[model samples]
Target: MTKQQQDEPPILPEEAVADDSASIGGSSTSESQASLRSSILDYRRENGRTYHRMSDGKYAFPNDAREQERLDTVNYVWMLTLDGDFCLCPKNDISAKRVLDIGTGTGVWALDYADAHPETSVQGVDLSPIQSTYVPPNCYFEVDDLEKEWTWSTPFDFIFCRDMNGSFADWEGVIAQAYKNLEPGGYLEIQDSIWPPVCDDGTLKEDSALYKWSHLLIEACDIIGRPINQTNKRPAMMEAAGFEEIKTTRVRFPISPWPKDQKLKEVGTANQVQLVHGLEALTLGLFTRVLDWTKEEAMVMCLEVRKDLKNLKIHAYWNGYVVYGRKPLSSEDK
Candidate 1:
């Protein structure tokens, strides 16, 4: 989920707006009839105005300086958690083959994969069409909505999903779909952070701000049927979705750089840097008007909010569960 766009400059309003690059009074409501999508979208919302959309279905970092900082934090910190081993094996595990990078934000991971494995072909998909249109001969981008149905021509040897905590509604559905799309003996990897659940002094309490914040966010998503708080039981869900040989790893990152090991300490610092700026955006980005918080209160609370990320001993982390399985090989291989 790492990005390099301008931090959103406004707050938010619900509902999609018209593509004014087109004619007026012309069928804004008709999803089927829309002629073209905007190349550089800059639209107005209740909070003020917003710019080109990102994958989460809204123009985040909208209008507020603090919000952009928060998002940049989340994006960069999560990138740190992408351990090297996670990227290393798939190449050797399978012969040079086609791959899928689900939710390929900014197309960083996909590009990295392409660079590492020259023989493999990679396809990256996102809602915003924000990926660079120009790519290696083996890499391509498609603006497909994963929430709906996905139809790819070829079965893939590897599929990757990451940092989609704020974007997807049907986590299991998407996982199952990945299972369906994978070739037998192929592999799939999913990585996401556990949002809003804080570990206080290495213990997660029910009432901590992280916990409370998480609950509110879940409720907000429940209202719209697009909730994203499903982190704890991902392994079992994957099994149910038909993935086998699932491997789950929980890496507890310091919310704000507080690890004893030098290597891990660097990770903590990265998480902390992101934490300082992500507080306002994560707290109010979706919940303010949608959840209705006063602008003054959100700003005030955020000052103290990021401090929580610094309690290194507090053991705050966005747990990444990478559960992958092999599609059953055919009788011939067996």
Candidate 2:
């Protein structure tokens, strides 16, 4: 096999240990248990969409099953794009001792990584407590905000974050924390897709519903002080955070089933499914809570966007960027 192919981690068939009954903490009534209880009770619901109350509505998306399905589909699509590789950091020969997934979502990535590398300890942290209880023994999930101060006791060998488009208010702070919490020579990999798909042809006009939706979403995120489109700036942010040996790869992610090529056609089909399924869930809160749009108005806009998504003539695609960097071995190396 080629070196690049060899670098990919093999897909393991072993089943991950399940622990559905596990909660945040034990039954003890200690201070730590009380704190955990408070965190668990911090979940809030708005118009059927669940959100993390700890951050006080900092994260825009819902934590319901619809969002979870979208996330899992996106993750699977990414794996398919990478030929089953979970990460692109060149650490094939070395087994990461400790790994951290910043926005763990359902903790599927952490569980898969832990299952692949049984010797590694994988910790997935998120603002919501939606992660599955049954997970690999080596994998653990914690409820915490990534923008807040990190409380990790030890440095990790690798860190991974994906699909966190509108979650972080301060991306720089999150990268800085990752750098600080990573062991020297550790690697950090970030995978995110650019918003507002680009269309080279004239099929996607500025007046199109897709274009209008993208504009509104971008404007809303900008007003909130957490810009959603950071695909281009991530590499520079990592460099500024003192990470070295940085590398970036950009892939054209299809937005609809308009591509003639077989691989891209498959990607486009998956994108269409995700976008159609998540159109309402993705923008309902953003429109109502941020843009002051009524629920009916938001749904009308969503319907228009969905129609545009299914239009094969648009030929639109989002740029997916994978950026990875390593911590310097010593302070002088900086």
Candidate 3:
């Protein structure tokens, strides 16, 4: 309690003392584990953008601030497309007690769902821990790979996935896993966009930059073993996974503000905004890493695509698919 003794340096813990000693000689077991964790947290920098290091080459998209803002914009675009609805699953179908959000990028949808359904306990899983720290008491996040074996012991009542078209190599496997992890009669909802958008009015020419961009993106994803054009094949996949009462809904997501309808125009405008910010983030990694293109070449291609996006003459639109299905009530039904 003396002043002299109080001012003296406090004795270090045994572990801390050992750590210091190890630092002077070599890396200890604790230090090695800490280093490995640090590497997982450390984002990888490529072509002036930062990407997730946990699943290094799995998802070819940036996880930095700019990309996060673009993702939020995409969320707004989907909201507008869905007429302000967060999901298409019927309220009566959801148990509202247990919910799982797969590939929750920023945890926005999970947080919103948890806030709206106070009784729901929501768990969002992603490869990166870039989600907001401040979350609803009923909602939390975990950093894990869904492609790996799921270790959750409890079954989820409702499992949801969105905007994950090109993020997986085996869609059927993921669907099977969801079916296995869901409670009997539980629901699984997936929302994704059809890639290589179609044009009905013949305005999207084959030589157009936007058209070329879409096809090239598809090719890149295919080469990387994660095809993005699997929206139409989801229903059959769900059915194969022993799901019943499957429902499929498609909405028009225009590329520009060229639609005559008021709501369509609004959705188009939001889509344009998202494309403006997302063009580079979406293409840079795939082009540079998968397609073996130079960074400048990729930027030029993005510039051309952006120009085409603003032309307003092309009537191109991606088909937004919202597919949901319910698990069978019993083993006999399954």
lDDT for each residue of candidate 3 in 1-334, tens digit (9 for 90 to 100): 2252255332211122111111111234686756755776799999999998876879899899998888888888888888878889874334468898999898888888898888889888877767887887888887777888777888987999999989999999999999998988789999999888877657789999998889999999999899998788999999999999999887778887777677888888999998988899999999999889999999999999999888777777887789999898884322
Taking all chains together, each candidate's TM-score versus the true structure is 0.74, 0.89, 0.88
Query: Please, what is the whole-model Cα lDDT of each candidate in the order they appear?
Result: 0.59, 0.80, 0.82
Off by over 4 Å in 1: 1-35, 39-79, 86-96, 200-212, 311-313, 331-334
- What digit string (tens of lDDT, one per residue) describes model 2 on residues 1-334? 2253245432221132112212443355568667766766666888777777766788888888889999888887788677688888965347799999988988888888889899998889887777887877888887777887887778898999998888888888899989998999999999998777776556678999999998899988888888878768999999999999999887766777677666777777887898899997789888998899998999999999999888777767777889999999884322
Residue 285 in candidate 2, Cα distance off native in Å: 1.2
Highest-lDDT candidate:
3
- The Cα error of candidate 2 at residue 92, in Å, is 5.4
Model 1 lDDT per residue over 305-328, tens place: 555555444555554555566666
Q: Predictions ranked by TM-score, top down?
A: 2, 3, 1
Stretches of candidate 3 exceeding 4 Å from the true structure = 1-37, 92-95, 332-334
Collision count for each candidate, in order: 17, 1, 0
lDDT of 2 at 283: 91
- Order the candidates by lDDT, highest first: 3, 2, 1
